[model samples]
Target: MSGGPAVVTRFAPSPTGRLHLGHALSAVRAHDLARGGGGRFLLRIEDIDGTRSRPEHVETILRDLGWLGLAWDELSFQSERLDLYTAAQGQLADLLYPCFCTRAEIAASLSAPHGPAPVYPGTCRHLSPADRRARMGQPHSWRIDMARAVERAGPLTWHDAYAGEVIADPLAQGDVILARKDAPASYHLAVTVDDAAQGVSDVVRGVDLFDATHVHRLLQALLGLPTPRYHHHPLIVGADGQRLAKRHGAPALAAMREGGADGHALSDALRRNMLPAGFRLGEA
Candidate 1:
């Protein structure tokens, strides 16, 4: 929050699987943005989803990044900092309500037959905390208090390096998930808290999450966080023009390693795509 022209950016990754093309692009862009400004690039392990997160995955990520030749100035682990995430959860406790509405319930509540976005019917937003806790003891997910959040902060803006200006309405994204039905903390809550605490000035990621800016902006405003610049690069899609997903299968980094595939080639490809060789933020 107390910085000048130096851009402090971070590249966060989840340790659920081997790094893919999308991850490579995000890491490279983040590295370029921070180094481009003669600033700092940080690495954050987003292992909020305890179920799928594995220690081996974390180790492999470090290996993958080293192979890519992408450098970082700082490193953080979301799992290691549970207290922060817990504090944010407490801040959002009453502010956030328990969502007992299952997917079936939400779908049934969709009254706008032809609306572009399926609006929430506010099925569980009005539950008392005690009642919510009781239901949560059984099973539930938690959402932010959009009504209170909007009242606290008006509409916020996000400036993207790739896209133009962007504005978001928190009310539309009613009650986003800060915690899952099973886990206590969520990716959104952990990422926002980490970014705010680290004074991250720039966010570089794949354009596929362009809409997520709205959610992140809302979190920043609600939590009184410093708004950071966002830069979502073009996603690397398959020949079908679809995002790289596990279904279609990406060449696992382990598989590549066994095949004698060099890791630097990944970053080299990324450099060729957007930034030139040896190009930093200032030069970019």
Candidate 2:
């Protein structure tokens, strides 16, 4: 914990599944970061995906974190913050365009011969005003014009504890979705907005989101939000060297808690980087 304003960190997990050891590692790290700096730890339920987010899963998350001897200073649910996200999107209206391309259409476009690092080919980026107006009745997602956005917010950068200062290159990711018909806000938009709203000064999570931080830094500049110092820690992996997930048979925290495992002992082990058998931390 470096010297700065009191650190406010969050463990925002989607309530689509149970909390596993990997999730435990993230939560403990965030908790320690906040507590170590005499700051606040927030428990935010990223239940923006209405279809997949279940109330039971959220309950299990609470139980799991509690069983691990972790406590949060505040709690929030993304489902209740739709209005804030919508307002944030409105502020970036000039940089956004409606994307009419379906998943199948985008996949087909990417399948053709293209650059080594494939991204959205800007299929709907050049639509005429009349064409866009005519398609207003159809379902579509709102995508940010990456080139225009980059030009508007020039020479953006953010600091990471591990990666150091990073120059933002959001253009490589193409026009990313801000809003969709199925969801009021995309992951990128919602998390950026929520983090700012919560006054999170230190973002501690997995290194996998390092690239996404580039886009987030740009968004913070565009939206006039503060850029929080980031710490993208390594991910916990199983014997196969794959990140822990339900598909990989990662044991859920609830299961371990229910099985009479010592919560504080497990928490201490994770803090000391003592992983269970056949598990280890890996780089992104």
Candidate 3:
């Protein structure tokens, strides 16, 4: 780790599910990175999805982290920062537009053979003033005008500890949602704002979000927010050679704790890159 600003890292997990081994690895990495640098580690609950987030899950998250001996300097919840996200959306108003497309409609539009997740085609980008006015009362999400935003921000770049300097290409995921009808902020918008607001200097997480960093870099540029150095670590995979998830029967940290498994030992094992019988780290 190069010497500079005091590292500020965060373990941000959504309260929609319990902490699994993958989450444990991420949290321990972020915690160690901050503490090792004589910096700060924060615990943030990403509960922006009101429909899925639950209070019970949040409690379990705190309990699990405590058991693992990862004490945080600060704690926060995304649900409590609605105004910040709203303010960010306001700042980017000129580069945003209302998107009223439903999931079914979007899926139908991209019925042709494509990638696992198809980029959204701008169906409502060129709507006339009257057309937009007529749909103002309908449920809608605010999406970034990718072309205009990129043009305004010019070229952009961000650094990852593993991948080195990366040229941002936010255009690949066209017009992503910034605010949703159900939630005040989408993951992309809220995370960018929160990381900046919390002064996170080092973002340590799984490699699954490497591509998402491109979009986040663009957002930081557009919002005039500082970009943080990222560390996209490999994911914990099961014996089946798949990333662990609830569907794969990934055992939760809560279960381990209840079973009287030693949390410190588990944390040490993870930090030392030691895994249980059938688990290993891999880019999934």
Q: How many residue pairs clash (N, CA or C atoms closer than 3 angstroms) in each of the candidate models, in the order given?
A: 5, 0, 0
Clashes in model 2: which pairs?
none
Say which candidate scores most in lDDT.
3
Question: On residues 198-242, what C-alpha lDDT tens digit does candidate 1 reach at each position?
Answer: 989898877767666787888877677888888877766655555
How far residue 199's Cα lies from its native spot in candidate 1, in Å, is 1.8
Which model is ahead, 1 or 3, in terms of TM-score? 3
Winner on lDDT (1 vs 3):
3
- All candidates: TM-score: 0.85, 0.95, 0.96
**Model 1 misplacement above 4 A:** 1-3, 108-120, 128-136, 274-284
Question: What local lDDT does model 2 show for residue 241?
Answer: 89
Give candidate 3's TM-score.
Answer: 0.96
Model 3 C-alpha lDDT per residue in residues 1-284, reported as the tens digit of each score: 55777899999999888899999999999999999888999999999898999999999999999999899999999989999998998899988889999987888998584565668899889898799999999999999889999899999999999999999999998889999999999989999999999999999999989888989999999888999999999999988888988656798999999999999999999999999889999963
Off by over 4 Å in 2: 1-4, 112-118
> lDDT for each of the candidates?
0.76, 0.90, 0.92
> Which candidate would rank higher by lDDT, 1 or 2?
2
lDDT of 2 by residue, 157-254 (tens): 88999888888888878888999878999989999999999999999989878878888988998999999999999999888888988666689888
lDDT, candidate 2, equals 0.90
